[model samples]
Target: MITTVQRPTPADWDSWYTAGWPAVVTDKESESFHRTVQPYPGMTAVDLACGNGQWMRQLTAWGVFVTGYDFSTEALRQARAAGLPDGLSYAQWDIDAEPIPPALMPGSLDLVTCRHALPYLEYARVLTDVGRWLKPSGIFYALVRVADDQDNATAQSDSVLESFHRGFTEAQIDGIGIGWARRTTYRLSARNCGIVLRGYGDSDCQPCDVSS
Candidate 1:
């Protein structure tokens, strides 16, 4: 069992949402997210930590069966106001505190997208959870950045491994992408903002098994 570093309570999280963090679900992120998703008309997907349901709207527009989950009521309200497509659904959720519920079955999803959400989670726990939820061929997509990944553990802890995100290898880790996921990365053109994606098998995927 992987244990994630503890974080601010739900109240703190609620406060962040109330301050309008999920206010904008822009086109670039949306397009990047869209590229990661292999949606079909009836394909089932889960958008974890779906702030303002940006991916939900985009996926639904492509004819995917998108269901969104998040921890904040205010964000969910913003999601509702985002004009959800007819094929989309939503539920309130906190992935850190609880396991994926029955409504979100393991190995049942075709895709899972998490944009700007991982910085708030314990990286290892989040990765394993996503692996569990994905089916044999299911794809997992997330947008993580250096800016949103700060925590107090780094300020006081002496462990170098723990101080930095062990998973981040100079802003590249598990991802098999070309472009950087950090906030400061600049793009020469619109198309230059693309990803350097790698493919991993199902939960049983071994480290050397990644094909892309």
Candidate 2:
């Protein structure tokens, strides 16, 4: 029989981050992205479910206008406390909701980065919205959970972690990147079973590489 996992509230998430919970994506992941992405000044981007706004700070430092979205009050508080310079902003929203906010309009962004947060939301719906929100030449960056990973075991048990509810497949990623210009995917972990999806809108799409 299938069991239900309770979702964590904003306060719970805040406490988790405050406790210095380590993030899955570190220098290696960011290096991979920076190597692939060519960020220009005035570029508009969004960090979906941005925790503590580290990625947003990086983008802002690179002169990209960044908007961060998250529901955790404490996380946002930390981000604000960092004293964001111009070109950075934040919004609070439950990403699982049916319609995304109007601020994330269709074809308006140059990039959208989502890390370790896809499982909590309806994966397909969020993917579709990300695609629509991207400009014709925009890029989508994501680190998503897969069903085959041991991390998914929580999905079989009663857990409050979002990973328990989120998983992905190559076919689903393909379906989401229908019109992407270039697509590169890599596996990040052996034990966790996660994949990094890098989809560009202006370049020619390439074959999916699962070997990583």
Candidate 3:
């Protein structure tokens, strides 16, 4: 049985991107997230932990000014090599160790997207900070990998490898819901173990109650 596998460190992530991650989401799945945001011209968005700039490319294509941030240098290198268009830029940051960069001003972002990347760090804290950075009408769109009771252990075999921690629970998702003006969730397929969460931020909502 698989047991006692260590969580991925920054260096592990660097190598993961170097070797490449085989992203398995469908076009419909990606379109679902895009449809939820409906990002328009002149909108500013940040894609936290953007691995290889997929979302950034989509958002920029929709005329959104987008910044893709990732801690892994190799990931950023790969993203930059993709020939990012105008209205798109990238920054290297260790989200768990630092505050959101000052350039990404509070209440100035139209959207913030984190796709399949939150489980590698302190997601709760990251979500709270993301809530604070958004504009009143902004949306926090995340495709998160939720934890399950199955075996996700890493081994030295030729099987498919998973990089993140176990996953998040329902309570954690609900805790995120409490802070938004409105929140909607769509569960992905069994292969992903993910949920597409879109949280709208407006003036009337309370701060995220993460204490639970």
Instruction: Predict model 2's lDDT versus the native.
Output: 0.70
lDDT of 2 by residue, 160-198 (tens): 454335555444444545445455666556433333345
Please, what are the lDDT tens digits per residue for candidate 1 over residues 27-47?
766655555444678877888
Q: Model 1 misses residue 69 by how many Å?
A: 1.3
Name model 1 segments beyond 4 Å from true: 1-6, 147-212
What local lDDT does model 1 show for residue 114? 75
Per-residue lDDT, model 1, residue 122, is 67
Number of the candidate with higher lDDT, 1 or 2:
2
Q: What TM-score fits each model? A: 0.67, 0.78, 0.80
Q: In model 3, which runs have C-alpha deviations exceeding 4 angstroms?
A: 1-7, 22-25, 151-162, 191-212
lDDT score at residue 70, model 3, on the 0-100 scale: 89
Instruction: Give stretches of model 2 more than 4 Å off.
Output: 1-6, 22-25, 145-150, 161-181, 188-211
- Say which candidate scores most in TM-score: 3
How would you order the candidates by TM-score, starting with the best?
A: 3, 2, 1
Judge candidate 2 at residue 183 and give its lDDT.
57
